[model samples]
Target: MARRKFTREQMIAAARDIALHRGAGRVTLEAVAEVIGSTKGAVLHTFPNKLTLLEELLRSMCQEWDRRFDEIQSKTTGDALSAYIETWEQSDPQAPSYLEAVAVARAEDPKLLEPVRQAYQRYGNLMQLDGPIATDALVAWMACEGLVLLDLLGLHRFDQTTKDAFFSRLKAIAAAHNGEGT
Candidate 1:
């Protein structure tokens, strides 16, 4: 049987799956090879080491989110904050946790959080681009972040009705700040 050769994307996805399902501590090269049905040497050839593999996975996840946000922004006539809320609301609740990557990276080296931190800083900057709505937008953004953080940590679950009300209220706030009254 010919061994399946996994692309970089496939390997990173497998590593993320391993981390998300089994806990971040389990994202070893050997484990990834087994998960993807490739050799340990094949995994190493792509990632070189566990830290490198996980770091790339972290970066890839952030980039993917940014890409999705850009796509959302381009498609919606809504303001950035409202679009952000919608994006969060529409995300898959059962998707693999990117937070797992952050946890593992932080444990290995605090510096590994640089990419994550930078992505957030960029998000903050983007939220501030609207002059009139900046403050209210940030409030909405923080509120959305709180909800998302709680969900990500598995600390809270709001029913769809409650979430709809929450997002509607935030959207109204953003609209009001733009002179479009609720």
Candidate 2:
């Protein structure tokens, strides 16, 4: 039989799956190799080290978030804040979240969060509008992030109705700040 071939993306994906399901502490080069049906040497040939693998996982997650944001922004008639909120609203609840990446980063090295921080900084700049309601826009953006954080941390206590109300209110606030409507 021929040797199994695994791409860098496949390695990273296997690491992500391990981190998300088994916890970040469970993700190791050997574990990833096992998941991908390869050898630890094969995994290292691609990642160089466990830290590199974890960093790549976090970077990939950030890149995926940027792609989703851009896709929503392209279709949105409102401002960046609105696009950001809509993107969160449309996210898959069962999908892997930033929390998983964050856990892995925190477990391996705090510096792994740099990609996440940079992504937030870029989004922050995009959400900055030139108007008196800039603060309102900021608040709206914070609220949306807070909602997502709560849900990710499993601290969200609001029922579906309350969550829907919160989203509706957030949309209205974003619209009003954009000078569209309340």
Candidate 3:
């Protein structure tokens, strides 16, 4: 039997998938290599250490969001807000699981701090928002993030009704910001 060689990209993706399934602290070079059919030494050759791998995965996650936000922003026909809303409501699957992992790792590792900060900064940029526009969109984005984290932590349960009301309020905020008098 022969071991597979994973590209830097494949290894990172596998690491992210592992973290999402088992949670961040449990993710290890061995775990990722196992998932990718490679070896711990193989992963180490690519990434100097776990923090290095996690940092890259975290950055890749942010870049993915930047890409997706650009895609959604390009659609200009109907309410961009609606597209934005849907984009985020379904973003976890579309984006990497690294952000959720960051929340989990924040209290201990602290290596995650910079990447998550950079991610949020880029997020504000990608939202195509500035000044007051930035305020509303940032709040909305944070609200979505907080709710998603709460759900992930089993602290908050959102039924369909609550989801609808929250989204409705978000849309109304966007509309108001657009000066449509929502």
Candidate 4:
């Protein structure tokens, strides 16, 4: 029998599937190894420990968000706020899984959240929001965060009609504040 070679990306992807489907708490080295049909050593070689694995997963998620945000910013000729709203509209469905892993990692060690924190801080700076529009931008931003939270926790879902109304209001705010300050 030949030993299967698992690439780092393949291992990470398997870990993500395990975290999302089996639950974040269930994302163990053994679980990942089992999913990838590899030895524990193989998985450990890619990720020294479970914490490292989760941290990489969270970091990748944040990096992906930044990449998408940049893409949105580049394609949009509107204000930063409007670009941000459009970016939010293109939210990744897999975000909740990464968020769940963040929760688990944070519960174990608060320092694990540094990457996520830094990402958000950088995101705020990139938004170029200030002056009169800051308030509206902040409100719209928080609303999007609330929506992500609701989706992640599977607490409550907004029907299409309600979501349409909410997004209409958000778009209005974003459009109104598009080029107010800068």
Q: Is candidate 1 or candidate 3 better by TM-score?
A: 1
What is candidate 2's lDDT per residue for 51-96, written digit by digit as tens? Answer: 8888888888777777888899999984788888888787776455
lDDT of 3 by residue, 42-92 (tens): 999999898888777777776776566557767743445545665566575
TM-score of each: 0.86, 0.88, 0.78, 0.86
- Cand. 4 Cα-lDDT: 0.73
Can you write out model 1's per-residue Cα lDDT over 1-182, one digit (the tens) per residue? 77677899999888878766786778789988999988999999998888898789888877777676778878876456666767776777544333544666766677888888887778777665467557787788788878977876678989999999999898888677556784
Which candidate number maximizes lDDT? 2
Misplaced by over 4 Å in model 2 are: 96-99, 129-131
Off by over 4 Å in 4: 95-101, 180-182
Model 1 lDDT vs. the true structure?
0.76
List the candidates ranked by lDDT, beginning with the highest: 2, 1, 4, 3
Candidate 1 residue pairs in backbone clash = none
- Give the clashing pairs for model 3: none
Residue 91, candidate 2: how far off, in angstroms? 0.7
Better of 2 and 3 by TM-score: 2
lDDT of each: 0.76, 0.82, 0.70, 0.73
Clashes of each: 0, 0, 0, 0
Candidate 2 global lDDT: 0.82
Off by over 4 Å in 3: 77-84, 92-94, 104-108, 125-139
Residue pairs with backbone overlap in model 4: none
